[model samples]
Target: MRRLLLASCIALASLSGCASMGGASSSDIAAVLASPSRSADDRQRDARDKPAEVLALAKFKRGDTVADILAGGGYYSEILSGIVGPDGKVLLVNNPGYDAFGKKGYTERLANNRLPNVTHVVGPSDALGIGEGVLDGAVIVMSYHDLYWVDDKMGWPKVDAGRFLDQVVRALKPGGVLLVVDHSAKQGTGSAAAQDLHRIDEQFAIADFRRHGLQWEAAIPVLRNADDDRSKNVFDPAIRGKTDRFVHLYRKP
Candidate 1:
């Protein structure tokens, strides 16, 4: 029954002509962050994450139909639902093998209908299964490196990054935002550090997106940690949640 309920929600979101707002404002974010409904853990991360700033930079507006790609257990989904309001929708896209990382089921976030305006999309990374011209924006947060790092043994199929991003680009409305926040690797290593260190070279990523017709917009250092040496895994005890990260915001134009 839980699976059925989740499927129904995804179907509702997949339908074309869903209403989406144009641009977001500061109040939209402030209200979402300040809402008492947000979990304690969610609020605790504010000092490190600054989600309000992330949302503002991404231009996520009220009534917007956005996809929280690689959204594990709805941390961002819940916040987004509050920001977008009842009229809006947040489609949480999770590729296979996502549960192993968190030791939680794919429906953990969707269970009991905790987020009334949220939907779960389970599929291959390259084919999002979302409709064209339907998304106001899509935010891929802290997990872009997985496109190059996911191994077959992990039950996740190899992602064709070009196709995956192409699909995301197609789903957005004109001038729609596609914001990627990821751990920063060394200056010239490219994707070499993805599997081991769980990071990616910033310049290499920009070039990859440009190849897919995504226009470069802005890069913010909101999550920068100067002490991180870009050597050990992101989960290392020394830098776990404090690794230097780059917020690369782009557009489909």
Candidate 2:
């Protein structure tokens, strides 16, 4: 039965104009946001997160298989599901630590198989359980810093950043897109801020992805907040939702 459903979904997706080149239009995104199935909480967050604008930078097409890596509570997963329609698939991936942290949220979002195209996968940081060259696109939103974080008590162990990235890079097909969005740290701080401030140095992130052989495609400044001094923790009450963030897009060669 499950296989039949997926096959039907793929057939429907193949018929969509979404498979054509270029990103989703503003109208298309707005329509997704306006979905009655979407939660009121997610709609409220759209004002601050600007999800429509961020997703536009990804240039995802219909029938595209995408992964929302370390997706906390499946916020972007739900949105991606709408954008991809019935043809594409959305992988809502979460490491063990993140799964524990966001169990309630994801459980609620995925209840009753509300998102048929989304598959929830929970695995370790080093092995995300996704196959090589299978993904057409992926996104890491605000959670990439977790790669550099280590908290034994919280169940987030020290991750092998290189190996972790290897899994992600290997999962993307040639020409597949990677979109990374994270809170920015001060210049030259590198991953230093990741552990304490929950932020990363923007330049360091670009260079890190480049080292993995993904071509730097574009940097969109839709979420930049200059007033953020890149000092406080992203969870700090003073700047929780107002931190400066960097949005970078990369592609497999």
Which number leads on TM-score? 2
**Residues 21-40, model 1: lDDT tens digits:** 44554445655666554557
How high a TM-score does candidate 2 get? 0.92
Clash count per candidate: 0, 2
lDDT of each candidate versus the true structure: 0.76, 0.86
Clashing residue pairs, candidate 2? 13-87, 18-62
Off by over 4 Å in 1: 1-22, 25-27, 99-108
Q: What is the lDDT of residue 22 in candidate 2?
A: 65
Q: Best by lDDT, which number?
A: 2
For model 2, residues 160-182, the per-residue Cα lDDT tens digits are 99998989999999999999999
Q: Give TM-scores for every candidate, taking all chains together and pairing residue i with residue i.
A: 0.85, 0.92
